[model samples]
Target chain A: MAKGGVAAERRRPHSHLREATVGYAFILPALVGIVALYLFPLIKTAYLSFTKTGVFGDSTFIGGANYANLVTDPTFGTALRSSAIYTVIVLLAIPISIVIAALIAQVRHGATLYRIAYFLPVVTLPVAVGMVWRFIYNGDFGLLNALLSLIGIDGKAWVADPTVAIFAVSAVGIWTSLGTAIIILGAGLQGIPQDLYEAASLDGAGPLRQFRSITLPLLTPSIFFVSVLSVIGSLQMFDLIYVMIGRNNPALSQSQTIVYLFYQKAFVEGNRGYGAAIAIALLLIIMALTAIQFRLQKRWVFYG
Target chain B: MGNTQPRHHQIIIHAVLGIGAVIMVAPFIWQILTTFKTVTESRAVPPTILPAVWSIAAYERFFTSVPLWSLLGMSLGVLVVRVGGQLVLCSLAAYGFARFRFPGRGLLFGVFLVMLMAPSQLFLISQFDLMKSLHLLDTLPAIAIPGMFSAFGTFLMRQAFIAIPKEFEEAARLDGANSWQLFWRILLPMTGPTLAALGVLTSLYSWNDLLWPLIVASNKHMTLPVGLSLLQGQYGTDYPTLMAGSLIASLPLIIVFVILQRQFFAGIASSGLKG
Candidate 1:
């Protein structure tokens, strides 16, 4: 109860250490937790990536050998390419989210219905969503094919065909993520005041004109946020690929994301060294892209 | 009046929303529909929209095949631990950062911000090794451990604590309340909404968490989603059974969402805004 200890321990100069002790004690658990789980692991993985690891988890440092192997690894190329394609496709959801969020923000009626309908996918188990979508994308006797037949078009093996597999899985990825993007954008939309629109309309501006000026400019921050999140999320895409295109599938090679490839090498093949290398590779790509986005944001991301 | 134009615009809005909603809702509707259909009907060339005979056969198979009760219990057990850990650890760390002026405060928090930025994949291999060393592999606790360390949750709660009016703490200090008392009684109680928000978000995440649990837990220790994934692998073509399993896996949260719709939406909105 040292009342005067506020503002950097003005009470007693000796009590600063005591005050800091209390602070350290308070943060000790979380600090220890992250140090153990996140920070230490990050360092350990980096160390392990350079080693030639054995199945027994023992390792000998081999200095860039794993990275060398990663360079030559053909599957790495496919994984990186698939990950990039998925991120690009999923980024489309932000524009889609903007329109939907704008519409939802405007309408007073059935807002709850629209929100809940979209949010269902967000809450559902990805494994389940992946399973159901795989069935729907089945070559024969699938709901998608059946619907296509109604429109007099035939459907191919969506998750099984190597050429179509990544796109098919990307579609599912986009579908599940729509709710999250919309929720963020919806909140962002709400922060844009109603009076701006009313004033714009009073000035005889069309709804589109008001949106182009007032809505879009103000919504840039949310759009940027969603894009960063989407890029990160899409790059880590694994659950749908694992569920929809199983480990044994011929299409697995074409559709696997970086995380999936990491899982394969680290877990399945017991090549922890290679997996660590892949993980580090993904981290570099993500850091580079996120940095670029942040750099680019000044040009477009409006604060007000 | 522009009222006529507004009414006309409303029709197109509803139509677009309605169409999108159908696309959004169809897979789930189909999952529910196909759950009741016989194998014959589910695999029919032109798929039937609704089941000719409504049946719980899929449910029966899913129940009888998987160790449903154990996995569900494991899911809940892990959920409670993970959520509890977030509330306690994040609150403590946030309180410390918000209220204190320690020597390494900024640097330590910078460490946390770095952790938050890196993807979960970066830590997986080493975390797996750590689990092995600790002999926690294939255990429900392993599924719960890495999740407990949440840089994101800490940052969120810290921001919440910072946003609290400083008057409460000053008043509490005047009453000779110590730091712990100030934290538990005066500060923590006021952060109820943020606490609830963190709890809800963490619960959703932990409940639906797949990859970590999928990696660590092999059998009886598998959480709900991991178990559901295995069920899919085993019953690949059995849409009915898979749908039933998937529905069961997702049911608890869906029910919670339906009941606490406002809070969940509020939680999502705030998490989106702050997060």
Candidate 2:
């Protein structure tokens, strides 16, 4: 890298160097961000996972102690279980979104209305979503209970009961994500050429028949994509749980997602080493899932 | 176009979709209704469809209880720096990667991709530590810094930049336009959609971000979401006030989204497609 303008450098020396310098200058700001946020932390998290911190806030190399401790830690276990449950449950969004996207695609009128309605929750702040849902789940005066009362069915404290809390949170998770999946799948639906359906129709294929033959196979890529992203996003779920099932809630223990546990251990409990270990474990799980997804994509995701 | 569904089928589709749409926006509708209800009416067992007395009592309580003004200010502050920084820096980097044949370009861009794929949790603990060491804990910048640039934005801008024909760059260069001038005046202007999409996405993310600000900032530097979360925690059973606060915090983004629905949808589509 040189320190002159292109004209000056052409008349002088190191013109190639000056060009490289300018190129580097252009990327320097973003490079600083990647390093500061990603690269540095990645290596640090890996290292800290293997260490323990003293009372003085200094870390000692106690290899695998944090990892071994996590194996027996009950809260970690609960968080892991809840997170897995959430991931599995939210995967339902894929099929739901597909149906909605298909339905929206067929409509010639009021399509944007449906899109806006479905997508509104996705844009609303999660804290707000959590709060409103919490209020809706109130045992005595909640909306859910009120709605159930009309049918003579009883509704329990949806977010208050330990047994039902994670499911409650999972519902919100699925709700927030439907909009993104619908948008993506809707785009995928549009990309399925109109003539494919028209051609199928000329061949006497009914709507259901045409859908199975033309729409399903072509939209598999988006389906596969939305599922993978949904799972990844679901595993990292925090805000809704944090707001809806706060510390004082009886269901907090049962509803703790892995990331919630990570925040608690690292910051609230001052167990950075264990928290780092949990984070690494989550990273590994995500990688394994992605690998599994790619392997499975071959079976269904039509690249064409 | 040849196949409009049968009449009965269209009726059924609309019926199902209509119900689903209602379910989707039900909470928001409730939030708005609850915001204006009296405390007693808001909690009615049968639930009043509308408040017998539409009131701003909850708003008064919320404004008095929470630092709504400052929270909004901090969130806006974070959003501005984050979105502005990402657009400028990401486009510059993307432009460089698009145009330059520098050594390590492949390696560095690969690194950016890795960062792009790595989720936020991987970086949280360390980012917090970095902020601590710099004595920046509980600062607005602490909330805003990590998101000031993003791998997603860079990659998106890079793709947009690469799609620009090479002849334009050669033409600009023949005019003796420097790299800055080329990016600022010529090439940058051409990337309007990409820039707009990234800006909208960045602002939305920054505004709704909870975990980072929840961890990093306390009362003084608290962003809107974090503040709202705390409001929920402290005012646990106060549905009216909570809904009121939530509506106020969410209104700005909702308004912006309504105005820039195209950009919002485009931004969301790009992100999901990139996956």
Candidate 3:
């Protein structure tokens, strides 16, 4: 059909407009869908965040009340702290992942096996990862506790204890994300010109010195990329806590992430207005943090 | 700088890599082994590497107890629709930006980028509200409609399409191929790797997604992840049975990653670098 159209267009000069119109026609479905579904909802959400509304379609204009409630809400504060802690702890995994990636790249044998092993957690469904980790973190018959007993160290109920619960969930965050970071960094490592390393070797540079002066600087782009993404992603943690911690768990208070709070308020509590406010606040925080990273990248993120 | 030093360095690298590999694989090994074990043996001290009573009880129970096959069918159906729609729509949008001049193109593309960066939660509440108003709630369309068009896919396909040399299109033009013919017959064939990569990514995301499905689909149209989570509520302490069910749910994604590791990395790496 397309070939037939081309042959017809060749005989007439007036069909160029028709051809260009077809190009626009091809994109119309997606454009219309995005506008109606995404853009309409986005603006409506912002409006609803500012207004007071109930489930019964009663909406009243209330300026700044929801945002005010967000500022003073105790749950919001706890969730913010949890989100910050989760972001920092999960970000620590990125550097750890880089070191592992560098090591894996140097191995000549069984690289494929190692790659598959490391990437298993990332490729698996998050619900599965959450459930598996929940089993491992169980207090009495959990594998971690059993292993700890063999070494004469008693393990606590990891995901149930308030003090350790956030860290427990963050561990899964790190574990699942390590594969992605490693793959990106490994690719960057491969792209580095080998001649530079050879030149450094001729200059009597040791392995540590070569890595410090060459690999670290050259890998900055991927490092920066992973850092920004990890931070943003960790700040929005919800699924693991939702599945692993359960709703009525004692440690739920300590490990409630911002998105989880949004879920509780919006769905569980039926405070759609308040939930929209928290979601907006989170969006602002993310946008600000990302903007700062972009601004700071001029100073440190080396493209080469 | 003799052969001895190089050998020593090689030894250090292997030792480091070997330890890292064990840590990465330990959890999966534990999960797989426990699935085959009986209830008591799985929880035993100094955990057994092999199940004492190797039986198909857990696997058999999983297939019999849960609506596992129906959930698998639901997930595959949604994945095919969503991925197919995304590929067709995103490629057309990409083509508009890549090959032709159009009005409001820059602003439209800017909206696409902003949609990419916007926190997914912000869109959820209103999207749900919209679905409710439209009477599409609790249906598969609620899940499929919102996800069918992705901004990230559009941006990625645009970059890939733009990277193709203009001479190919110009030569086609001289040969009397119009825009539709050029795109469909010539350009589309050349985008095999990018399209394959996008297909895999879209399917994986839609398959593994939990949140949106949890919000929209309740009983009839529940997806794999949502169904699996609900199953956890029903079967809490039975680790072996739970592991078997999860293993079944995750099998498709593992097969995908194994087959397309390179293309997956290329697609993800390109997007990450640009971001």
Candidate 4:
């Protein structure tokens, strides 16, 4: 469409110049924002990563010192592990969400209600979601414990216990993301030709058999998309952990992800250099993982 | 066999989804209930599902104690600038990319795509420095500036504009309409669904945004999320007040989602899978 428009405009050279000028004028603001806020900072982060931050947030070039520190830092290792675990745990939502989407698809009525109910967490502010969950996880008055006690079991301080805090936070990550995954998978399910299922039923295929043969194979593209996004989003988990687990919590160290670590180092401690390095590392990890997903997608994703 | 089995399947599906819905919405229901309960009842042993004596004291305290109104005002101001700016600017840029043969259009659009993948946190330190140098830190503009233009919005609009049949624009041009006139009169008015989708998503993002506003604004200038986070920090043990504050903070977006639920879901699905 655009090429045709351009080709026609090219017939009038003078008018073409005016059109190009208008084009530049139109894109100027977005261009400025992209350059100033995105491109420049991206480059600056790379540069800042090699420097040593001063007390006043100024940096002096220190030549891979921050990278070295990050490499040997036990805390960085722990954060890396926590983030990986969290990402994996959150990725579990993909299959769970697929099941829910499939179930909702099976129903003849009230699909909209199921979608809305699952999606409440997606729309609610993460801070609010975190707060509400925090109340539910409270050691004293938490609903989780209250329910557990009824079953002849006891509950610990879920978010405060170091061993379980990361898992607790990851559970929230899954719950919040389930809605988006369901919606994406539900759309994919809708796109499957109805006759394919009818044919399967004619062949005397059971529901589970039809799902395994028809649904899973056809739904790979959406699955790939949701998994890639969920991984990226999970790797960048900050607001939920920051709000739910909090700074003073005993499990803060164990629950902190890479982005949370970056926030603390750069913003709280004013160690801009180290923080920039962590952010860059995270950027590379996300890019690498996403690239891998895209490459691996060829094996599983059925474009048809 | 088929008919009876399917009825059984229907019952099982309804039972599963009904139970799942309860688990999903339980916290929200609890949050609402806790907002009206007194501190004592809110922390009652075994956790009372309903408040014995319903009172609005938590809401009253939240309003009186915190600068909830000003925080809301600041949040609204940021929302208007961010959403309005994104609509106008992203639409114009999308138009340019879609219809104009600029020299670096592909390259520039590529940069936008790259930025979409790069997390926003990478820019925090440098953007903060830029804000400080420009004297925007601790101000509403500071919160709004970086978010005013979104590459995602531009991309969505570009797709919308590209889907428009070229004949419409060709006819407009033949009628002696200039590029701006063509865009404003012909193309812009036709992208209602795309515009609505982008608007709803952008507002949802701006309303729920925490990290940027938390870092940029302080005290009276903080947005609702930042303010509510602070409330949690200060009143860590005050369940009722915190619940009340959180409810107030999240109510607007929830209401918006309820009203425009289809657009909201469409926006999420399209953005997630397509790009």
Error of 1 at A166 (Å): 0.6
Pairwise DockQ winner, candidates 1 and 4: 4
Q: By TM-score, how accurate is candidate 2?
A: 0.95
Residue-level lDDT of model 3, residues A1-304, one tens digit each, is: 9999888879665555655577577678888988888887788778889888666557887989999999998989999999998898888878887787777777667776777777778779999999889989988888889888989999999999988999889888888888778878888888888888788888899877877888888999889889888888888788899888988789999889999999888867777788888889999999999999999998998886
DockQ of candidate 3 against the true complex:
0.48
B-chain TM-score, candidate 4:
0.94
List candidate 1 segments past 4 Å from native: A1-10, B1-5, B273-275
Off by over 4 Å in 2: A1-16, A54-56, B1-8, B273-275
Query: lDDT tens digits, residues B1-275, model 1?
Result: 12324676888888888888899999999999999998778899877888989998988998899999998999999989999999999999999998888898999999999998898988988788889889999997789988887998999889889999999888888999999999998888888888888888888889987888888897658899888888877887899999999998898998888787777777777766222
What are the Cα lDDT values of the candidates? 0.87, 0.88, 0.83, 0.89
Q: Record all residue pairs in model 2 with backbone atoms less than 3 Å apart, i.e. clashing.
A: none
lDDT of 2 by residue, A1-304 (tens): 3556656757654756667788999999899988988899989988989998532368999998898998998988999999999999989888999999999988868898898889888778889989999999888999989999999999999998999999988988889889889988998888888888788888888888987888999999888888888888888989989988898888999999999999888888888888899999999899899999999898878978
Of 1 and 2, the candidate ranking higher by DockQ: 2
How well does chain B match by TM-score in each candidate? 0.94, 0.94, 0.92, 0.94
How many collisions per candidate? 0, 0, 0, 0
Task: Give the CA lDDT, 0 to 100, for residue B264 in model 2.
Answer: 82
Candidate 4 per-residue C-alpha lDDT over B123-199 given as tens digits, one digit per residue, 9 for 90 to 100: 98899889888988889999998888788889999999999999998887788998889899889999988998888
What is the overall TM-score of model 1 with all chains considered together? 0.96
Q: Write the per-residue lDDT of candidate 4 for residues A1-304, one digit (tens) a residue.
A: 9999888777788877777899999999899998988899999989999998743766789998898999999999999999999999999999999999999988888999999999989889889999999999988889999999999888999999999999988898889989999998998898898888888889989989988999999999899989998888888888988899999999999889998999999999889999999999999999999999999999889888
